[model samples]
Target: MLGTDDELSYWVLVLTGPQRGKVWLVTAVGAYPYPYPQPEAHGFAEWVQHWKTHDGWWS
Candidate 1:
């Protein structure tokens, strides 16, 4: 999960299987390994871009 600066928090996740390489935005409730909703992107490149954009913020 990729955490955001917000308290409730937004997360970017890379899924596997049929949805492999897809990106998803999740709303975190408690701690690590938060529950995710659905995939927001189905492309690997899109996922990479999202990760890079948030990497600096969440790193």
Candidate 2:
């Protein structure tokens, strides 16, 4: 099982410049946000939910 600290830590990366519209989910270890909904959300549930509620994703 992942520790509380590990489970709670995450990041979102939005690309700029030529890449433009790419957004990513980054973590202390690492992550790759998928092209589809609810992909690989296991440890990032809290953060993903927060992002969704706060005008992110489909909001």
Candidate 3:
């Protein structure tokens, strides 16, 4: 997890997986999948890069 707010409404920017490189977002727990799996970009740096260009997340 590279960045996030103190509030625990969601475990934002969470890194989970065997190797711990996957990036999950916008959920109360890790990889819950109720709202979003949201894990698209693999590595933290890659996820950041995607965030820099993604539509809704950046807006």
Go through the candidates in order and give each one's C-alpha lDDT: 0.47, 0.43, 0.46
Query: How displaced is residue 53 in candidate 1, in Å?
Result: 9.0
Ranking by TM-score: 3, 1, 2
- Mark the regions of model 3 whose C-alpha exceeds 4 Å error after superposition: 5-19, 29-41, 57-59
> How far is 54's C-alpha from truth in model 3 (Å)?
3.3
Candidate 2 has an lDDT of 0.43
| Candidate 2 per-residue C-alpha lDDT over 1-59 given as tens digits, one digit per residue, 9 for 90 to 100 | 12232465444434455423444444565655432255543234544555567744422
The lowest-lDDT stretch of 10 consecutive residues in candidate 1 is: 31-40
For model 2, the stretches where C-alpha displacement exceeds 4 angstroms are 1-8, 11-13, 36-59
Model 1 segments more than 4 A misplaced: 3-5, 28-40, 47-59
Which pairs in model 1 have colliding backbones? Answer: none
Task: Sort by lDDT, best first.
Answer: 1, 3, 2
Estimate TM-scores for all models: 0.38, 0.29, 0.40
**Candidate that scores best on lDDT:** 1
User: Highest TM-score: which candidate?
Assistant: 3
